[model samples]
Target: MNKQIIDHLFEFWEQIGKHGNFLTKENGFSFAKPTNGSWPNKVFDLTMEKLDIHALCEEIISEELPNSIAVPENEAIKDLLRSKGLRATSKIKAMTLDTTNIFFGNIDASEFIKVGSPTEAELFAQVATESFGYPVDPSTIGALVDKPGFQIFLGNHENAFPSCGMVYLDQNGVSGIHMIGTKAGYRGLGLGKKMTQFLVNQSIENQSKEVYLVASQAGERIYTKMGFTTHGVLESYSLSLH
Candidate 1:
């Protein structure tokens, strides 16, 4: 599960880089332009080998959370990041759920959800921005629609598209659920959970054996109730100088 967690992240970025015009990837690092600054651009795959901290620090252009790196949860590693003038901004749980182990008592997430369409990238971005209070470029999600191995969905309620989520099925049949969000006005209605369930259901339908995500504190409870177990922790770091 740990290896899958790391590989899925790298592959997910690879898919995004393949279609995002303003995004670039090299080795385990990826970047988004300032215009698409709110996009999740970061460094990952640190467990495979030796890390070149000096070169990595040079690539960091800001101290913001968006300009972050995904690193293993280790005291020594975190101390090293801080020694290089970086700060630990977030500690998130890396969770995993085997599809066969799920037990959704009665929460039916079968609400109407539109499969991602290439023409609706702007719509996806619109819902995402409204939900997150951040600017998410259309291309940030648009380039992913109609893409293979990725199943994106828009949740509809009361004739409004206020929620969206995606499931990325990696080559090893590991599904990663990401970007599950509902607009501020539409939250507290269990829409977020529904979107997550919808993504998980899609993974089961596609024959993905395991599902994973790095959950925020709020999302951790929801996903845990959905049968996901915390496998480990992942910390995000950003250079102090920018």
Candidate 2:
């Protein structure tokens, strides 16, 4: 349970909700919902007690918004999700890279541009959606622009954004790389790898001593070759409410 990456995720949700959205933590239940009714209407922090899982599930089923719960690899939690007709839509691993004695060769970062404007954030969101097949709202991207301890980047492709990634430095000096993606037309070009390394390089430059990421199965292989080792696994039980 030494995983700070999961904690960072909750913080990530909290930050997103603070910007023209909603975030609430009370009565052993934490909620984050976006105004656009897009992805990541979450009920996380399962360690909290007194949470009426049944009632919550019933509410979600009754609503018309998409919802997902961050379920850990616990049989009890899985059983509860199954009882509510929830399905495992995705699984991710928390991988870590010790920055000590790491190599940072000459990095040509001329193609990477840090997101600074609302327009750029929109393009970043578009690339992310194409890369992951999930619609990432530009509002969320816009909120994080210029936010402290968080940095977003896009791969400049002849004045277009074909790839993108983000890095967040937590209070513990652990930087997390998130949402690394390349547009569909831009795949098979090693852009993912380059985007990842660029984010890592940026994290190291930010003076972080460690780096971690929540990686899907497809991304796990890419990080493994980069010397990242799995520290924990997270299962997300999704409900297609809409």
Report lDDT (CA) for all predictions: 0.74, 0.79
Per-residue lDDT of candidate 2, residues 1-242 (tens digit): 43477887777677766664577765656777775665457777775357676777776787632377786667787887787778898788988888787755755799899999999989888888888887788888898899888899998767777999999887677788888888888789888888888888998898887887888887888899998888788877876566
C-alpha RMSD for every candidate:
3.1, 2.2
Q: Which stretches of candidate 2 lie over 4 Å from their true place?
A: 64-66, 239-242
Per-model TM-score versus the true fold: 0.85, 0.90
Least well predicted 10-residue stretch by lDDT in candidate 2: 64-73
Candidate 1 per-residue lDDT, tens place, 68-103, comes to 877775677677778888888888788998888664
Local distance difference test, candidate 2: 0.79
TM-score of 2: 0.90
